[model samples]
Target: MSLPLNEQTVLVTGAGRGLGAAIAAAFAREGASVAVNYRNSGKAAENLASCLGGKASAFGADVRDGEAVAQMVANVKVRLGAPTTIVHNALADFSFNGDARSKLDALTWDEIAAHMETGVKGALNLIQAAAPSMRERGFGRIVLIGTNLFQNPVVPYHDYTAAKAALLSLTRTAAAELGPFGITVNMVSGGLLRTTDASSATPEAVFDLIAGSTPLRRVTTPEEMADAVLFFASPWSRAVTGQNLIVDGGLVFN
Candidate 1:
């Protein structure tokens, strides 16, 4: 039951740059028509689309808004095709500077809610909007981007980690519900990626420390993680669902 990548349409959210961009590129390489969805990085997204050529295009939509997401999907259907594969990789405005993170005592509910709005709520919006089309087609692939911190929590990124934990729950539950409709829901969790917009603030020493701790002895790149994402959407993983594949240079084993 391997999907013919050349015949599929993929929608990658927050794909203007970073891991999202890499993921979009991976799918395009497989001959899938890709919709690079971005909230604010319009220029970057368009540039990436051009780089990918005809099979890829940039779309603007805030996943947090259900109506906007619906519109985005509609647009994709018109410009590309109704997306049979969706990658939820959008992140709220955040930086990986541990020193700037809110401590437990100072962490406010609003801060936590901000992450939820994008992670959990946004996922819900995407599923609701895309599921109908997938159900009609009797095929769909939904991949949620997650974090290794949910398992290790070494840095105690309370708010960000908590939202991801919730997303994991959604991944399993959604998988169970959508299975009958031929939709697979899964997650790809990664540790601190070597260099992404969110992790740009991390010092080089931190990267070296993390790399040393991992069995691979190197930081995983966004491109590496993006490759893992492609597996879930490919025919090779047709029977796999409701699972989380962690891609962090073997730092944490699940």
Candidate 2:
């Protein structure tokens, strides 16, 4: 299934590594010019861009900051092109293996704010910045990288899960609002990705539990989730919006 995104421009946040990098590469393989957005992993992002083998440039910015996000979008337009498609995959400073026991009592407000600020605010920033162009072009695809854990809370990532839940709501609201402008908003939620920097902190036992319980009896890879994101970002989902597709090896079926 080839997605005809040739000559199109896509901006993927958190593209420095993990699922973000895979998603960027997927779009690049489809001949789309990709703007790899990263917060800190500069070298990693550049390396991913190089491997993309297409028109790819890395843009560094904290997606949580609106001003930074606006500037990043400007740079993408000037350097690569106006991004007609946006993939919101950025996350705040969080660790999957972080102290979950202390989260309820010791986690500061700043910690929760930091997480939400990036996932939710960053996603909105990208949408607001790139939506105008998409509307003018009469075509746009906004795919948000969410967590299937929201539906089935196997872990105790309170802040992260809450933020993703809010982002899911935003996806639906954006879809309804942007639908009139030919822009569709959707979400791709995954569970226990095989290997990724973000998931590096996850314990092997956790993966075992999820994999054993899933119907496929295995964990999914970043590349697999990337395929799901590609579907939403491509023309095949033109009539689809406000939908959260969970790609977790059939772990959660709604």
Candidate 3:
């Protein structure tokens, strides 16, 4: 469905704060009714909703819980219309303190599962819940958030990077399955963002080093990455799917 920006209703997972909030606000700015899904940050989510005006509302649900995700989608349907666009920006709680992160040998199965619970499983829940409505209407937009680690494992964030890699696979497979239903599934990944809740733990020098390394000579911002996500949701990317676009400034060329 090549729906206009104003005619779309967007569901942005983990949209209470940080990068998620930026994505939600970006959708609202485009005149779409925004369902800001938050798992824990209710107050922050509520405040964001208020700031977004009447077109946006905050809904809390653990994406890891399939039933909860289904129910969340139902609530969004009644309140802001069924979400025709879904941006799975939700992430497991993690900080980008590479120095303190576990290496491959130290990483346990449990650690890996935790990230997948929110990254892969959460994405599965949202896709399943939204597929029915999307197929029925013959239009849907699903954008999964990814990372540039696949090309350049700059940090030893083993579990986190692994989870995102799985999500990338899901993106392509889902795109193949849902393309017939007028649903476009894609991924938008970025390099270590300049400043976000998760990346706050990163050292200042690391940021400076990364900025110097990039061709743009600056770190990407959450807001900038949010705009790239909008492309997949908008009509401009009508012919694009099963693809991952890296928004980092010449960090990793894939």
RMSD over all Cα atoms, model 2: 2.0
What TM-score would candidate 3 get against the native? 0.99
Cα displacement (Å) at residue 88, model 1: 0.2
lDDT tens string, model 3, 6-31? 89999999999999999999999999
Better of 1 and 2 by TM-score: 1
Candidates in order have lDDT scores of 0.95, 0.87, 0.95
Model 2, 1-254: lDDT tens digits are: 11368867899999998899999999998889999999899999999898886599899999988889999989999988788889999988766774443367776777777778999999988888888888888888899989988888877778888889999999999999999888889999998798988788888988898899999999999999998898887777877899999999999996
Worst 10 residues of 3 by lDDT: 149-158
Estimate candidate 2's alpha-carbon lDDT, on a 0 to 1 scale. Answer: 0.87
Off by over 4 Å in 2: 1-3, 98-101
Clashing pairs in 1: 2-235
Candidate 1 wrong stretches, greater than 4 Å: none
Candidate 1 lDDT over 1-254, as tens digits, reads 34788889999999999999999999999999999999999999999999998989999999999999999999999999999999999999999888889999999999999999999999999999999999999999999999999889868889999999999999999999999999999999999997999999988888898999999999999999999999999998899999999999999999
